[model samples]
Target chain A: MDEDAKAVATALARESAADGLRRLTDLLLRVADDDPGLAAIAQELDRITEELDQITEELDQITEELDRITEELGASDDGRRPVGVDPVAGRANACAPPLEVWCLPDGTAGASGSLGITYQGPRGLVHGGVSALILDHVLNVALSEQGPAAAGGELSVRYHRPLPLYRNFLATGRLSRGADGELRAVGEITVAGVVAVSAARIVGGRGVRM
Target chain B: MDEDAKAVATALARESAADGLRRLTDLLLRVADDDPGLAAIAQELDRITEELDQITEELDQITEELDRITEELGASDDGRRPVGVDPVAGRANACAPPLEVWCLPDGTAGASGSLGITYQGPRGLVHGGVSALILDHVLNVALSEQGPAAAGGELSVRYHRPLPLYRNFLATGRLSRGADGELRAVGEITVAGVVAVSAARIVGGRGVRM
Candidate 1:
């Protein structure tokens, strides 16, 4: 248990799988950032990799069984993972920081979180691609309710400034139909109430739904 | 040593730091992709995180010592890590697959490699943000030689097809000067000799130089 978990005892002791994945990612990123020694770190990582392999094998067996049951029951969602398991924005994925976006009453999707060292580029700044990743996911989430599924067509991003890392960020998106009747997701990520990155995405196959 | 390393004796006995990082990432991704049982996996990861923390602490001490020595000797490149350490394309970064770009005599930059499961977005496709991440780095590598440093201004990426995972990818970039004398980087990523994603960037501060 971590300090917070120790202090709280109950609520934080048994960390949720999503929060655990995020915590694991931060630990890995700590390794990626200062990114110390070469072969030596490799040796340690090699050892851990072995352990992860075992865990993966065990998980694979269970997942296969679960998937088989789901298929047999015909309870699949077109083979698409729910937003809770989304690779980028999903709370469960260890790939990047978890992104939580919600469609507001004003018809816009809004998301906010502080990124850590795992998503860095340009020395203490958020990688531009990361910005794109968040915006794209935010947009998809914004319009998911309006359509059955959303596939990205074209994405354009303009970097207004360098978005710093480990800082609070606010992202918002809204759905719009273009002149050709194509749905579009316009999104942006901001720090300190200032928009630093903006994006417009062309969506297809209906928007992504949770 | 693995079977291959034992067979090769000397050559494969030791893995490079970058290769080791990539290997570690793949193992982690296997867990991320299969994404099997959540809570159990987290427990294992939690244990490994403790080990990694110890390694990080040791490495940090050595890294600080080396940095101090480098500074005392005035052996710094303005704190810029070589392309080898780039967070996205650098072999050392476990964030994404390593991208190696080279300048061709034909006045263009060419790069190629197969991305792994860690970069997946759609079910079996590369994340669009990852495509942007790679293309963005590829272009910067292409134009880096033209100037001292490169900073991205505006980046636009168009996805022609859904790029698959664990497949060979070829990326190319070139240096172009806009009409207003602004330097730009244009690049594309292809799989099976077919262009799947293309990008153009407005670069500043001259261009990123190796």
Candidate 2:
């Protein structure tokens, strides 16, 4: 199992043990007034309580480690905008993408984007629909270089992957081919560069802006 | 002007006239105590208000007539979906499309799609960005069908029309051509069958579900 899973499991075991000890203490207290072995039972109960204290400490350590792991996972896959580049073309200096995005230099009109808190979807995690919105934005903006134009005449995206909540992600869009008045663009949204969603669009001449 | 536009204009005029009368009433009230001579002026104001009322009533009647015209204009349109029907193969339903999609007896894709509330982009009217989203959705879906069966790959869409808000809209997607495991799609979004958004997509075979 993964480190996080292991930590979680350890924490659960320790907590359960602690709870069991507390239950034993409660049973001992309830019978102490009537049982002739009350004194012995009281001694055993003291030992169990001491053990529960140790278990509680161990569980606390595991919970802290699990929190760190969760943060690391979230940062690695959260998809909003990219890092080290301007989120907007000319306004990069003025507006950084709410998330981080990476601009690829492969001449394929490629860009990777990341998202963060301002773009929350689910209560604590990103919403699935918001993930699609981010993909659409990344793909549409990535095609801005084809002819100094930015807009979508058509777009189609499918949820091939489940976008998680509050996680770092990656989104990439590329211009595939172009001819006459038509151009083709494609993109993918990923978690830590793993494809979570795939999409495509057909764009034509600079028509009236919608 | 189109019927919808005309209706809008007439309604605006009537609203303006009513507002004018109300303003005049306030003006006369303010002047009543300041100058006895203003009583004469109030008579003139009354006459002007009566004239405005007449114009307002006439415009209201015209607006009602125009409303019918606008409804008719919005109801019928020339947009269709094209799916080749194979009578013996039971593939005729393939040609059926989303509601409001126009179709010819022949299986050729139409050039327009109607706009609806789901396409809203802004607060009240259809948002330009949302309009683009709709166009993209249609083109990408159409391209998916025309491209390789396993070609459910990445795609992109471009917006070429200003899809107006609060008006009946039409949209279309056309498969221009496909080659080398790559395919091209093109189409336009229209308002009342008038072009509002244009799009294109380049698709390939990879992650396509269909």
Best candidate according to DockQ: 1
Across residues A61-95, which tens digit of lDDT does each residue of candidate 1 receive? 44454444444434233343433334465443345
Candidate 2: list runs displaced more than 4 Å.
A1-97, A101-105, A108-129, A150-152, A178-182, A205-210, B1-129, B132-160, B164-210
**Tens digit of lDDT per residue, candidate 1, span B1-210?**
663452232122112333543444343334422223434345544554444444444444434544444444342323434333345654434455655656776558777777665566767787777787777767766766776545546677777788887788998888877766877878788888898988887754332111
TM-score of each: 0.63, 0.31
RMSD of 1: 9.4
Per prediction, fnat is 0.17, 0.08
* TM-score between model 1 and native: 0.63
* TM-scores of chain A, one for each prediction: 0.63, 0.43
TM-score of chain A of 1: 0.63
